[model samples]
Target: MTYGKFAYVYDELMKDVPYDKWVDLVMKNTQKYNIQGKRLLDIACGTGELSIKFAKKGYHVTGVDLSEDMLMVAHSKAADNGMDIQFYQQNMAELEGLGQFDIIGIFCDSLNYLQSEQEVLDTFMHVYEHLDDKGLFIFDVHSIHKILQIFMNQTFTLNDEEISYIWNSYQGEFPNSVEHDLSFFVLDHKSGMYDRYDELHFQRTYPIEIYETWLREAGFEVVEVAADFESVSPQTQSERIIFICRKK
Candidate 1:
């Protein structure tokens, strides 16, 4: 329920996400797979960015996240944009009674926040239960390559008028895991003062084959695995990986 300041500044920091590409991919795959109805549940749908996009595109979209702070931001954005999106505060690992959907998405590297493989398997099982037969499940994850090559022992900073962030990534004790130490300096527009806040997030990724195996165990038919946002062959040295799966 507490996202601290990470939920508040999440959108600003992730302004570069290629949401249009995700939408395009969803549309194309849904059509190709004959997923007709528009019911969709976006797990860990931070701020409802892509959820609202689907709503605008005529999907009955529901967005769920663990952070009430993030859902508040998502609600405000939906109101501002005049989009009707149902945003729920819920954990993805144990999604319950969330009815069936023709499409389910877990994008934006949100799955990276899970700290363990058990959590991942539980989440996959929950998604399988909520998906209609042959429903499409599309998501993306931070590749192991990214954890080692890009984030390992990395220090990065972002500066802007409304918010500033210093992010440091360290190798986790376990293989294929990374820990993020984030400090934020957010400006209060009315008070003209900056408040400092901090959050620590842990992430780990298994091999691609592991995910495929788990998806199959969860009753999903594994489909294609593509690099990050690319549709075809992966670009050399890709840092992100995408999975397009279907319910069996």
Candidate 2:
């Protein structure tokens, strides 16, 4: 589950991801819900993209990720930007040591990487333990339609003079899960050759009801469940589901 070489190339490949939308979601809900604290925790905050963005928005941001390589990149970026974000290498399910936060977010579909229901529930409970009273816990996951209909058995290719990639998706062992097999080729200018790297990653998601129930079971009150950053209930073909909850 290590990103290995993928850590360095992640930002370039994910340049089109809606990072601003996630930050907007937090600000919108914080204002709407009257959350005033500036302390924020970014779970699975790969390479600290959202963490740095949150910091820029005046949040006292702390980032946690399982991959040290990703955290290394994040730390360097934060230092370069003169940001004081605290980056920690830790698994979200077993997250500890860091104190409570006013807002805890698991962005970029990182929650989907959990392999089992127990781990998901454990993560929810741990997040509850680390949130201040009435703090917000926001996360998003890939909708089932996206996993089965849009991604399953799909092959995607990216071609560039400097970098190229071939990505394939297949059904995973767990229900509502998909495995991504990626091969990346980066051109070495000096050698006039390509250095190839391969990675396999698994992601799973469940019915929205299941996530809501888990949040409540972990002492949270469901504030909103929206699809694709819109404040509307999810429809049949929604690609992403977002959840916003408040610690009770």
Candidate closest to the true structure, highest TM-score: 2
How well is each residue in 169-218 modelled by candidate 2, as lDDT tens digits? 99999889999999999898999999999999999999998998888899
Each candidate's lDDT (Cα)? 0.87, 0.94
Q: What residue runs in model 1 are displaced by over 4 Å at the alpha carbon?
A: 233-236
**What's model 1's lDDT at 56?**
88
Per-prediction TM-score to the true structure, in the order listed: 0.95, 0.99
Model 1: lDDT of residue 27: 91
Name the lDDT of candidate 2. 0.94
lDDT tens string, model 1, 196-222? 998988888878889999999999887
